[model samples]
Target: YAGPLLEEEALNKAAEKGLSSPEFLELCVWLGSQIKSLCNMEESITSTDGGKDVESFQLEVSSFLREMACPYSSLISGDIKDRLREKEDCLKLLLFLSTELQALKILNSKKMKGSHLEKHNEVYQEVQTICDALGLSNSSASDILPLLTNVEQKIKDILSKVQNNHVGKSLLTKPLNSEQVERLGKINDALRSEYECRRRMLVKRLDVTVQSFGWSDRAKVKTDDIARIYQPKRYALSPKSTVTLAHLLAAREDLSKIIRTSSGSTRENTACAINKV
Candidate 1:
């Protein structure tokens, strides 16, 4: 199939829609894992286009096409690009989704032997059957799908052994998609932007306050030190910086006060508050 070039406008469109679809997220995660697998390998597997004797190249490609079909659309759409650049949360989500997808791949690898592993194995077999039936077993497709089921099942067993068993639960229950992840990226970006603006305003206020106290800009008055004076663990309490949060809170409070005070007075104390506080 012909793929579209990942144009800026297409990327913008994907970003605007936001990855709100759970299917999309799952698809992205799968693609990521497959790409990683394709990129990394033992030296022997790298030289030949993966085993040449097992099956006809066209047949192998066709078998892998089913798995490959979903992700290429997103790549062409540029959904992953914007989502990746958004924030830590998106990265975490992407990684989590990818882990689940890899788990699915592992599950598809091993043949059905145990009762618990039966369903997953069946799915893998079914996918292979479908590929054969659909005439998609071509050499042009990657070989990932034939083994995807077994790989994903094995990963499931490993995940079940984790201390935080919630990983499996979340993967099994969460219905997130590409559109949703894209939406999350937007939300994160908005928060980041707001936080940055407030942070900068607070920094400016702090600088003016220090200057008003007859301290030169060269005289370093670390915000952490200021917060520590108030409470020793103030900054340590949260994973992030309390001093930064405090500055933003104070800046907001000061703004509210100035707005109230400036309602009737033309010569407002806004400057004084910024400089003297």
Candidate 2:
């Protein structure tokens, strides 16, 4: 029932064809089983059609991504691979969003239960811990982190509503209200400080992560540096004798100078003999 609603109608068409075409029966059976499994789940399954209700939506979206991951695995080539990667990215985003939302829900629930609003710092710290454990990747964190600001605003709005209700009604005398106002101011200050610190930390990590795109190039250059250029010498060394081309050139120059300096008949005869040779 939910499968047809959640999945496209073509799934049902395929199931009908499965009765006549044996080739499609396998897919039909698998899809039917998947739907049956979902139906068999206890009523605890949230009926959040596309996650409209905050709690119900989160639960439903989480379950939806897990199920979508199945057909995503069947993708073998072309754009499907990209789509699969996108789905994976979406999964991570959902995970982060759901984790944070769930945490905020818990915190708000506790606050609503009269546990004391002073413990918001502890609650924020716990949320930070959960974020770290998730080991978020660049591909997903960008898409997911933005939702945090929205959720944060929602939290602030809710908290403000709670405080407003408490402050209204003239429940406290002027002096007591003044003292409570001071405490509330301090709490807000502490929360602002924490949010600033967390934002800076996230920014620093994002900068490093962005720089990592070039890190592979840096690694390649470092590897290439290990290889020195092969320089070719003009002459080779003989056993126990290191003879460079400079030595041969110098010797030839000396011989040429000797021949040039000679000017007598003997030199002329010698030059004539050298030329003949």
Compute each candidate's TM-score over C-alphas: 0.22, 0.16
Q: For residues 1-277, what per-residue lDDT tens digits would candidate 1 score against the true structure?
A: 0122136454344433434433333334344545546433221111113454322322322233323442423222343344333434333434454554566556655333464466656665656655555445433333446455545665567667777634323222344578976776666667767776777777666656644654445435554465446345333333222333223322432243434545646546445665566
Off by over 4 Å in 2: 1-176, 218-277
lDDT of each: 0.44, 0.43
Question: Against the correct fold, how does model 1 do in TM-score?
Answer: 0.22
Clashing pairs in 2: 51-57
- After superposing candidate 1, which stretches have Cα over 4 Å from the reference? 1-44, 47-185, 211-261, 264-277
- Judged by lDDT against the true structure, how good is candidate 1? 0.44
Please estimate how well model 2 matches the true structure, expressed as its whole-model Cα lDDT. Answer: 0.43
The lDDT leader among the candidates is: 1
Backbone Cα, N, C clashes tallied per candidate? 47, 1
